[model samples]
Target: MIETYSIWNLHGEQVDHASSSNAPRVDNVKPIVDPNDQVMGIIQDVFPFASTNINQEGEDDVPTPIDSAEFEQYKKLLKNVNQELYPGCESFSVLTAIVELMHGKIKYRMSNLCFDYFLGVFKRMLPTDNCLPKDHKHAQKMLHGLGLGYEKIHACKNNCMLFYKEHETLDTCPICNESRFKMTSQNRTTKIPQKVMRYLPLKPRLQRLYMSTHTATDMR
Candidate 1:
């Protein structure tokens, strides 16, 4: 059976005359998705792609060998994460806790100082053997190592353009003539971007999809 899709403008009006090759320059074309089609998968809960080779120990049964440097780095991280903080609790558990709390803080628009204070409390209350970081900066380092982080890019506050590529070093927005950074206090020297955009690296994430046998087969 043949299925058709509609092109919609920004105002939610259907553009009957909008063709892929002949659509007007001013009219933006957004293709309406088909609910029955796999063109876009069903929206559901966020989950890690399941692997058939996952062992009873909740680890990947098939270990992909890496270079000595990478192996050592993984070994170090494993050591830090596997440490028994207090009886049944491993240091990795604390890391997950920090991750969940940070996720909630961002999701709920909680205060940064509040989150840092909570982390400080965890550090003080938990066993000294626990590998939980002291603050968001250290937590970010651990998350980045685990491939769960994003890159920050500076952008124009008015959304005129991104401060990327050839525009990377510019101090002001060429289109709007607006300052790229906000005015800071005389005592402070750090130049903070007027606005920032978070970007997730695609390479590692794409590789991870193929690691799952089902996802790999589906992709093919």
Candidate 2:
């Protein structure tokens, strides 16, 4: 029976056990275990190359983090605005207040849904007096321009589904069989309905609000 021994070796370190004649003629014998307690094979010795250790020699450079106080203030402002705008009320004052708050805050980016809600609030808050503020007039002008564009695009082609480019030719109207035709920018010639133009202001007003908010820090 041959005397056997088990030993643990560190990674990449060579172990030699064949120095003596009585140590068993094992050449490059490496540790191997089987399901049964048996020696399985011999393996070549391998060593890993040494590398320099990196030393971090300075104070940890980390940013001064935002404290809970600032975060709480933001949350409180957001909550207050949400409360003022909620329940879907038709009050321009509340909507304007919300818009003002959102404009002041960097977190809230304007969107189409927000614009629609703002417009709804404005419509509800529109005064019986014909006179309007300069801002309101500007907003209205932007809306009217968009409305006119929509109308022009919708007019030349009977159906909104028809591609804008297809409207340029008098060959045939995709929506209706009318041979009469007119062309506008980008080869668009379809005639959009007047009714659809009425809603164009809704998008433009929202766009104006967003633009105004981003362009100026102060709402004035």
Error of 2 at 40 (Å): 77
Q: lDDT by residue for model 2 over 121-188, one digit each (tens)?
A: 65467544422222433433322211223333333244434323655443555556643444446656
The 10 consecutive residues of candidate 1 with the worst lDDT sum are 38-47
Candidate closest to the true structure, highest TM-score:
1
Per-candidate Cα lDDT values, in order, are: 0.63, 0.37
**RMSD, model 2, all Cα superposed?**
26.8
Q: What's every prediction's RMSD, in angstroms? A: 16.5, 26.8
Tens-place lDDT digits, model 1, residues 66-149: 466555545444444444445567223444555556778899887878878888897899877766688877776654444445
Where does candidate 2 have its weakest 10-residue lDDT segment?
39-48
Show where candidate 2 strays beyond 4 Å.
1-137, 141-152, 155-163, 169-175, 179-220
